[model samples]
Target: MQTSTGNKPFSCEVCGSAFSQNSSLKRHMQIHTGEKPYSCEICVSTFSQKAHLKSHMRTHTQEKLYSCEMCGSSFSDNSSLKRHIRTHTGEKSYSCEICGAAFSQTVNLKSHVRTHTGEKPYACEMCASAFSEYSTLKSHMRTHTGDKPYSCEFCGSTFALNVTLKLHLRTHTGEKPYTCEVCALSFSHIFSLKSHMRTHTGEKPYSCKICQSTFSLNCNLKTHMFTHSGEKPYSCEVCGLSFSRKSAVKRHMFTHTGDKPFSCKVCGSAFSLNRNLKSHIRTHTGEKPYSCEVCSTSFSENSSLKRHIRTHTGEKPYSCDICGSTFSQTAHLKSHIQTHSRIGIKC
Candidate 1:
């Protein structure tokens, strides 16, 4: 035969693909013609070749004839087993023509090419949102359907995506897999690691369209949007007060419960918030992280440094409505208001 003799004489005029026999060339021409003669009876799935349909039938039969020698992983088809073997072999034969990025699978390379071509074939019917990958579009559909397929084994929490469930599991396991190279600090989630990195780089990618105020994290930018919109979603059940943040609502609950969860070991003092405990610890340690550039003076808290900066700028924001008098500090404004009350002033 011509195949054994290293000859492919039958060539197609369309793509110039040579074949060993006329029958082989005729089968190869079906690719250019967009023809799939073979079809599965069960699913009605069509294939260009008979071997592919034979492999598709195995899925209906639940048959795995081919298996990996390295990991004992099974596949319905031999080509799938070969692709699975590439994971062990670390063979990335497929490369992106534009970026030269390599992938072990042809499917991954095709997805990568879409990044260069700006091709988003997969689209959601609910929101008209598009994605390059079908898997991503499938995940986006969960937002509309309210379907959480992935559930945490440790806790009873459910997530729409498997990756979110994996991140939630780390909270119980106390696993800090992602680490910062700059500070040697660790985080459970990759997003937390990325946000922590922005603190060092001072990179604020998220910007508010209204005020043009930028934030390092997207969550912070979303929270900042509430300031512009005057939207406070989180409400306190105890006092019926609303807050822009859930953490503020949590801190408000401690005021009602009188629960000082954060405790200072040095002075045996307690605080409702963790940040308050951190600030209290700095008093004992004499660690003034916030410094004034004008007078070279330092303070334990950033709020104290901000108040000190107003002294240099002479910026008195707090003003009395009755007297039209302004004070540099709130304590001074309160003292001034007491004078008005002592003099039988209605204000």
Candidate 2:
């Protein structure tokens, strides 16, 4: 069948998306109407169009109807096969007028154009937040509706997005597709491996304006900024103590509940906090992962490495509140406080 490519005669009334034919517009309308007319016989999976149901059947049957002659690669649909062909031929028909950037598919080129134009065609009616892509807008809409369509068969867990669900499936399957080249370290997600790569590269991209301190991830920088700002958002209800980090508040909750959740497999030692359990685990394993660039010294805990750095820089940040005596370690300052107590007076 000849492909229909010309001025789109039909358009969607709900989202104002243009379509080539009335049939295409009708299929698009089902998205807004929540209507699925076509249903699969095997899985009972429903779709808006008969074509989609036919395509979905291939998943159950494990059939590949279309094949690439160049690479001998098989695909369920002709469109997918056509897109795969571009990889071999290096042919990109869809070109952006603004940037001259070419992409294999017209959809990708359209998404690329949005970056240059700053055009967000898809907008969330609930939040008024606009997105350059329709898929992103669909994900954003989930926040308002609290709907999770994608569900995991393994653990009865549901996710707002299919990609999130896919990642969650890896937890059950132990599928670590993303792997590091340097250390051969595997990650369930690509972003985790990217963040892991920064450890080897020492690439701290996210920086704080307050102290010029950098972090591997943006979230770590955000948490670090809370420390500089003295913003203790997470407050303990039992003790009325505020903490800058939610993890600290979580640890504090264990103190009230007397719940030791994190346990060691080796020695059966238990701890309230995960970080403390990880530190204790190092004692059994004798693993000193954190290393200093200067003098090539290593420590089991990150706090120990931090204190070791003070020896080189002579950075005595901890000060005795009673006697005005400074020390590199807080424990040293606490130990000196005893001396002041014996003297029968302090600052």
Candidate 3:
């Protein structure tokens, strides 16, 4: 039989779809036949195609042929190399037309688009709770299954993904390559440096339309919106207590489980939260970036500097109705009004 040049010779009669390659048409037929010809020699595993078997072989061989020319970083496959190229080029072609926010990958852009459209394609089979990504839905399934595949080599601590395991490894290595140019502050990851950069630039790009308040991080903005909406999606299965943030729920779980993973090396002090440990480290380093413009006084923390700024601005957003008096700090106002109230109800 003579094949037409412009026509699709291979077609799926079941779905009424056309394919350019005969191999693709053959692969499609496997859905009906349940045939897996390509089997792994190492294990009792079968794949529909030879290409899948070839890619799976690289996991056992640890053969990373594709490498980044700029950093000499290597990956096992060409697809990973293509994805890593965007980090060097800073080319975020996938953009949201609604908010003008760009993402490095199309999948991330599609997830962001769901925020505006309120579309959730991936749903839990156990519950009606939905997610934008299939990976998130898979992770959600683990809550029900109690499956933790990835484990730390040093410790027996298990995680969901290999990338998370790699991030956790940095804590043991004490390798903080991502450094700030202005303050010389180091971070374990590039994303942490990117978030810290916003503090120096004072760039709050993520803004709430309803409240007109802005935040440097999207996660912070989402948490802030919860204050207005009163939406607590993450709930405790044990006690039924809910939290807007996942980290809050994690910390709450620690309260129930009595888990304190973060510890200080200098004094051997333990902290429930990692950020509390980070703040405690600042006391040892004497690294105070937040400084006062009015006075030469500097503070080790941003919150202290924010309180000091109110003294210069003389702007007391919080007021006492009973005493008709105001103070710069909320703590100061609460203390001052304690003299007026009798039943521990300070004005």
Candidate 4:
């Protein structure tokens, strides 16, 4: 028996789509007709094809008929089971024409191809922002609506997306799933783990256009760009003092608010900024991390270490305005200022 090759034997009546076989044309007609002849017995849900109905029925029944012999993992369908088997076998049949990156499934390869093409099909109606995936666009919509649908049962914490909620749950559960293959150092967030990976690989993907300086994280590169632009958007409303980053402005607020959120666990010592708290912790631990190159003297704080370095170098940074006399510290220069005054006074 020979298969028909000259022309398409069947044609769809609804869409005028030609097919090689009558069965393909029949399946194509269901798209335009919206006819779902096959219905699941367990659930009220229906599907266009019997094969789809069979796959849907497994969700209600929780039946995993197809089992992998290598990993002992099971899947509802044979197609999913075949895809899972490829993970163990390292078989990637579907590949991208642009990048040549291979995937086990055609769907995954199609998604990867969009990266090279820069195709953002999913667009937000409220904003002009477009995303590569529908799920990303869905998450972006939450920002405009101020919708936090995902809520934690334990902490009463809310998140815009289910994936963010999943990550937040790890803080309570202490679940660090993303681990470094090199050192087994784990992080709560996937991005944190990716940032930590740069230490091992020495990879700096983010770079500054101004100085050509490289950074491991994109946010670091963003902050570095601000230094070149001399842009301080994050500013204090009261003092008119500005910072390149929001976190810097947040730390500066403690000067007015007198709020000390960061506290030492060992001692009851508190500090406004996290860096101050970290420096205070060294007092308890007796950890002098900053060491001088000239002398073997070590200091807990970096500022103290920098001041100490001037002793070895004999660098007089502070100078008198009236005379050419210089001092190592600012306090010494302030004392010298009184002698220059008509009436000598002490502050």
The most accurate candidate by lDDT is 1
TM-score pick, better of 1 and 4: 1
Candidate 3, residue 194: Cα displacement in angstroms equals 13
Query: Model 3 over residues 1-347: C-alpha lDDT tens digits?
Result: 12453566677767756677877888888877888899889985888878778877787899988999999999887878888999999989888999999999887898899999989899998998999888889988888888889898888789876678889889888999999999999999989999999999999999998989999999999899998999999998789999998888888887888788899999998888898888888889998888999897998888899999988898887778886787778898787777776566644
Once superposed on the true structure, which residue ranges of model 1 sit more than 4 Å away at CA?
A: 1-41, 46-48, 208-212, 286-347
For each candidate, how many residue pairs have backbone atoms clashing (under 3 Å)?
0, 0, 0, 0
- TM-score between model 1 and native: 0.76
Overall local distance difference test of candidate 4:
0.88
| Index of the highest-TM-score prediction | 1
Q: lDDT at 22 for candidate 2?
A: 80
RMSD of 4: 7.3
Can you rank all candidates by lDDT, best first? 1, 2, 4, 3
lDDT by residue (23-130, candidate 2, tens digit) is 878888898998998998887888988888888988888899999998799999888898999999999999999878889899999899889889999988877999
Please provide, for model 1 over 36-155, each residue's C-alpha lDDT reduced to its tens digit, 9 standing for 90 to 100. 999999989999999889999999999999988878999999999999999999999999888899999999999999989999999999789999999999999999999999988887
TM-score of 2: 0.53
Of models 2 and 3, which has the larger TM-score? 2
What is the per-residue lDDT of model 4 for residues 92-119, given as tens digits with 9 covering 90 to 100? 9998987789899887887898999899
Task: For model 2, name the residue pairs that clash.
Answer: none
* Error of model 3, residue 63, in angstroms: 31
TM-score per model over all chains: 0.76, 0.53, 0.38, 0.59
Task: State each model's CA lDDT, in order.
Answer: 0.92, 0.90, 0.86, 0.88
